[model samples]
Target: MANPGYCVKNNIYETWKNWEAVNLEGMKEIGYALSGCNQRFLNFVVFEGEKVSVNNFYFIAHPYNLELPVLCRVFRIQPYNPEMELGRTGPLAGKKRRKADYGKKLEYIIGFAEILGYYDKGGKWRQMEVAPRPWDSVYEPTEDSLRQFLLCQQFAQNALVVEIGKVRGTSIPVYLDLNAIARTHTFVAGMTRSGKSSFIINLVRASSNLKPRPRFVIFDRRGEYGALMKYGAEVIPYTEFMPAITNPDVIVGKLELKRTEKEVVLSAVRMLIEEGESINREALYKKAEKVAETKASDKTRTKTLENIKWALDNKGAFIDREKKPLDIISQIRKTPITVVDYSVDTDIEAQQRTATHIINHIKDYAMAQRSKGDFACIIAVEEAQYLAPEKGAEVKESSAQGEAKAAFIEAISQAGGYNVGLIVMTQRPAYVAKSVISQCNSVVCFRLKSGNDQEAIMNYTEYGSERLAEYLPGLADHEAMLWGMAIPTPFPLIAEMDVKEYPQKAAAFAKQAWERMEEKVEG
Candidate 1:
């Protein structure tokens, strides 16, 4: 009745029509692919009435030539006109009429885009080997298509996604893969008040919604993360959250004891632990006195004891007997988020020692959990520069700080396998330890004003080229460039989501204090 070849042709047409209905609908034609296009990059000339922009996603519509449209991101744009010369003082420009029209109608844009591959029938992004044909129509993807293009569909399907913010210039939400982030640490850097802390807070809040939620241990140097309590976090003051004293070297480092003094202190701590006594300031001092009496001359013993007493008086707040000791590890396991607030403590060395103790304990816990095939937790370090300064960067860094830095470095390199993630944030990227920063697999960079800091970030991320670096200083507050394993794209400019203001107790204003003093004098 009907020719078999004709029937096959009709079936092919019907199939293409169905695919076009789903894939081509709502795509706006903006340009045509130019001749210089390649597998990795696309060159296009924008239509006279249409527009294109940097960082926007577009697709080449060539259904017959390719099974699916190829997605690309425009990264560069320039104005061109064949009739007009751009050079002002050249002989060719001078010969042309001075009043010649350079009107909008005569100008068009030349767009350069990076080929970001195409989705296969299984909804996976696969590398595209074939380039688009010259003169093929280029269209701006619809919002839904753009979302499909930018997200890792497999990760999204598992609900292992957290919304960090919206894509810049669009309302489309951008999500990070939680599993990727947990497997590979993230580094966040920016100048103060550049929304670095706010971004971290948002990430923590979003992560709380996932199934089989991972715990958060936040070392909040400035006490800012207390607001997380509203989301079911336990904010423990630094003085009360005492980790078990498993190592005497921690105390020796904190005190910065001399050679003889350090040995005596270690002996004392060992004796206290072996006897099952609480490792408080009083017990430690008594044990040290006994060790000194047995080993040192009267003059040397006197000096060592006096030095130990002085150091303890100033930096041994954690070992104070009056404060009730809470087991930090137990809290970490039970709580969804545990924040150690250090706003009340001004001694930096003491803070370093405390952080070292807690980190060591967490590391051990994570390793144990890893053996059981359980994911442990994420540790967020705020003001990381103070605790993990670059080697020899701070002349005043004590042994305590050095130990803290070492703990962070080890955690960054080894903890991912244990399902422990580190979120290392700093206002001074140049001051943070290079080894620690280099280990982070994802980067969320905010506004940075210093050249050294920008250079440091450039070395860490794959997409941090000179052109991208130019955008750093001008980034608006809460705007950041996100790249690496956590996100699907190589890099994307995102407007960080707004977070609720946290509670911060304001200091007494100078004027208010002075007026109060004057009133008291009048009284």
Candidate 2:
């Protein structure tokens, strides 16, 4: 008996007469002769059963075995036409025709799904590595059939869900394995204003429901991530964190300072500790300056004191030196979020230095806490190039900044092992350190205009070739290409973003701030 899952199409094989001529490997070539149907590339096609049953329950009850119906997709298309015969003496008889014949036949060649496995009657997916038979009956997959065919067990019930982006065409909500993102690193690449920030905001919102609630440490370079801080993340500035730092070596090393100047600061702290002289907020700089005067030149001594004062003043007057010291690891483990805002510094290098310090501190802390078992945390770097640049780039490979950045580059290269994952988002993938981009386990890319940007993505991913790379320039707003180990196959997706899910755009706040002055005047 035929299964209700499939309709009987006795003459389906007849339409596949051209299959033998173009069938190479497992791809079947079918004629474009359907009266009302339109065939598109990448769309699913199901091979109908001639004397086979597709009902899952029917196969479960009976021991008789039959091959399951094949699911395939159109990969390529070609048109063939015969040239008209011309008189023997005609001048154009030997010339090739430039236009295609409208009446000529067109054929499409389809590649079978690279099936990893299939679900059994007992609800377990079994492994079967094979392709569809040649000249099998093929039909357009119905919506329900397509869902069942492409639907993976990972998307089924009880899995830790992270809403990635929606599948193109249908409203199917695509999900990411949150465990996978935490285990393997995720990289996001797009041009400026391509909705990368909004996509990330949506991802953070999705993560609110996870059990145990994984920790997140965000490096906000442009100060655009306040929406997350408002969502309960602890916002800390570089100078605010300075008060609690037991070792000033890590902080001073990255700040471009002369050797004598560094020793001056170091010696001051040493003298104060040895003599039991208590160093308070006001006396700290004075103690360090007194040490500089003893061995430093008059010119160098003055510069050292000025540099030390500038470091303290960098955070502006907002920071309270007497405020309780912040323990980042303990705070992250408790609140599970920490936002390092570099918005105070207008210079890019200053921001980079601060981020480098924070990342190094987090990496060391996470490694230390690993012995306690499963101490996983994620660090999201906004402008990743500064922290992890390729060799020969501007950031020196042997400098303190480079060494700090290397710690992260090394962690990501090891596939986020030791329970530390990295999410590096950049508008310029080409500028981002190649070491970081190459190690990404999964990549989410939005539309990029530059050829170099497209090429950078192609270099990192296996499925993105020059032909498909062309799609990067034409993707609709909010549309992106998601490829890598996280997905079963490379998919073109439309990101699901709800402004209500987080804060509105920064422009909205800027407008309100600008109009507030007028309100006071009117009042």
Candidate 3:
């Protein structure tokens, strides 16, 4: 139940023209305001059964600088009469005696229905505080919410807040509207041990259940996403893609004086190895010229050569001998779920290269499907830090994981309106390239530490630094602040994380165990 009333503004001297017309949405605001009042005002004066026709459009100016600008010139106002005194209260704790100052006229500007945004009165007409609603990828979304997400596109609303896991008492779920993910590129970032991983798991699961399910693929470096196996996602381990003599399509290549592309491919067959080498573009054109002078290689030959030389044979795998779509569509029609699992123990070069191969393959797949007709897809990078490495490290400057992540994001960001979506999740946010964040339209922010992580989040997100400063110290475990165009609001909002289902993550209290160790040491 909600309280309801008409909007009345003090600015009006004669004409109610500036006064917005009343509608259901405007009524909702009035209801909220009146419901927030004490129950004792249940029998106030005015508006019970008045037969007055209400207007529904109004102009909004900055609540602060009256002349600056209007938040929105005009929007429909939803109005409904919640009797005269809109309210409901459980038990009364205390109450303030009424004063003559608050007269009986229940008229005031209900709200800027389109700006359900957090607006501050007196701040600016266009700047009144509206509610915050963020996008929530973790939500499986009821039929009701989906319709709301689509039809409510232009509604002035805030980011949604979703609380995960619940106790009978004390633990209220945190919720954030993450509607931005659907419209633009998005990001998920946090520090190690924060709830970033758990939150990501839930997000993937929810995305899997969309109306037209999204084809989801994940880069599971530590095999953390093994849990997703049950969700029907296909896992492509390094072993499966490694070409061998047993596979008729594969052949060994002889090493040349200087590394030839063939030798590099064979060496990388076991573990896709990548180390960037400065090469001139003219050389590639010249090499193509030499190849063109001869007959164009057929598909089998091209694919085999690529597999033997490079870890990635994307298009070659799908094109036929004459450079046409293959009669057999195994590459495109197999499984919808793809998980490229790497090991935590693997060397940096190997893991980075594997991630690159998978990303390149996905990029190609999305492009191919679009040129033809195919299912739309979403590629999720779980614990992306392993693949999206930090600035060049001596261990593997060749990986240039940072550069790889940027490339991957750029490719997918361009696909959103086309036929693809990208979900990038990471525990060590700093490891993810700054450029990648701008490519995502949605985000699921879990608990994060370090100003660098917080600052990076602020740059491409709607969450403010002031809130970042306040929330950083109090990120209840895996919970995050989600914000982005993929979500609903233009503001940052909270999302309670759901990690209780992961038994592997559970453990005894650490502080108690540490205390026992200290006692033993003293003894």
Candidate 4:
């Protein structure tokens, strides 16, 4: 039998056929045809992998015919045939193959006609050698790529929808999703107030609305994600999610934290909670010992220490109008888009430190996942420099914010691949670490006014083209240059996504704030 965990990618065509059959028979039966304008395929190629199993790929024809690939990962590669025609004899013959399927995170490699068939492994200059296919109606869809999709389907069942969108009534509908251009990661950046936040919201909205809703855990720093609740998303605040170690008993109880290279992850957990002014918390923690007396109520003792730690840290964080530190527990338990709103968090240094506290908390949780398994989490940090900056900047790690930035960057940059995907929005792309931004393959870019920001974006992408370079500066509000898993090639699109669940338009508050100021002036 075929393994279930492999993946295949396909692009959608706007000026081409409406639908294509799933298998070879189905594709022909449905009259699936290809157009030259929006032709599919990418000339880009990553690392060359050895073809170990013949059943390690597939042809996915998903519902609604959306443009995205399906991922099929082979865990137990049983004996199979090279031709993939099935009914073959080999060692451990007739045994079934199994795979770990990921239909949600599919990276469709689009064929850039500008860089088609260029395989010189040198510098960026090699990209220039690939010749662009003519914008004509004579191009044909590859029976080869489709046949490869069929061979891949022997290992995976992810629905791959091929799409190629093109301009109306003119140019060839090009084959956008190419085979050679392998899976590529993306990073998006723009100047401040350039609608980057709005672009992110719209992108996630598209991902969530897929045939089967995608489960994403967003680490919201600005509290702006409150609108994503309509998708039935589950949001967990960094504060209250710590039911694991609220007291000495829970820490000493059945749970075990994942270990890191630093070795002080456990100590950091103690400091965030019951440690208090007493330095002995680490000693107590190392021994996994309860209090000698064991007379104090666990709830009362835990609460008191928690309050003390809050009081000390509160001095460094923004206080509500009622003078309480910005607590994330209440909001985390409420929605999937857990908003750790640091918008009012004015003390740049202090806010960064608080984010650090959350980062340490995430580290502990991730460590716990060693035996616990993937919890499916994604952490997003808006205005990332405030939380995860470098060591020698004006904001020194000597301060709490500086300290937080350091830890947040460490946790995200190092731990992101292990059940953690970091999402950050910043105007000064220069300040954000190269290591952190480079990891993001899915990037949505709006208008960037600075040459430095533009230059940074160019360095982190594999889809750069002369036309795309020209279009970068021309992006308007609601118009974005989206890259990565969403679309094929670096195409400009008019995003028509709504403001999630906010429903009615948010009334402008400028008049109200201005009126209050005027009244004070008159008085």
Instruction: Point to the candidate with the largest TM-score.
Output: 1
Query: What residue runs in model 1 are displaced by over 4 Å at the alpha carbon?
Result: 1-22, 33-38, 61-64, 80-106, 128-136, 156-159, 209-211, 243-324, 371-375, 392-395, 448-455, 462-467, 470-474, 488-498, 501-523
TM-score between candidate 3 and the true structure: 0.50
Candidate lDDT values, in order: 0.74, 0.55, 0.43, 0.40
| CA shift of 479, model 3, Å | 1.7
Native-to-model Cα distance after best TM-score fit, residue 486 in candidate 3, in Å: 2.2
Using lDDT, give the best candidate's number: 1
- Backbone clashes per model, in order? 0, 0, 86, 55
Off by over 4 Å in 2: 1-140, 153-159, 229-239, 242-325, 347-350, 392-400, 462-464, 488-523
Candidate 3 worst ten-residue window by lDDT: 2-11
Candidate 1 residue-wise lDDT, 333-366, digit = tens: 7898998888886867667777877877778778
> Worst lDDT window (10 residues) for model 4?
117-126
| TM-score of every model versus the real structure | 0.75, 0.63, 0.50, 0.49
- In the range 319-374, model 2's lDDT, one tens digit per residue, is 22357545666767787677776666654444554565555666676677767765
List, residue by residue over 1-523, the lDDT tens digit for candidate 3.
1111001111111122232311112221111222221211111111233221111112222333333222111112234332223352111111344332323233333322222221232321222442212210011222232222222223123222223433111243323223334335557777666766566566555444433344556666666666666766666665344221211123221112123344333343322213332222222223433443332345444544444333223322211122222211253256556666565455454455445555566566667777675645556677665555456522343334554566576665576664556677776666676666666666766667678777777775554434464455466676566555543334444545656334133244889889989999999
Error of 2 at 430 (Å): 1.2
Model 2: how far residue 341 lies from native, Å: 2.4
- What lDDT, from 0 to 1, does candidate 3 have? 0.43
Clashes of 2: 0
Candidates 1 and 2 compared: the better one by lDDT is 1
Q: What residue pairs clash in candidate 2, if any at all?
A: none
Error of 1 at 319 (Å): 6.4
lDDT of 1 at 128: 71
Quality of model 2 by C-alpha lDDT? 0.55
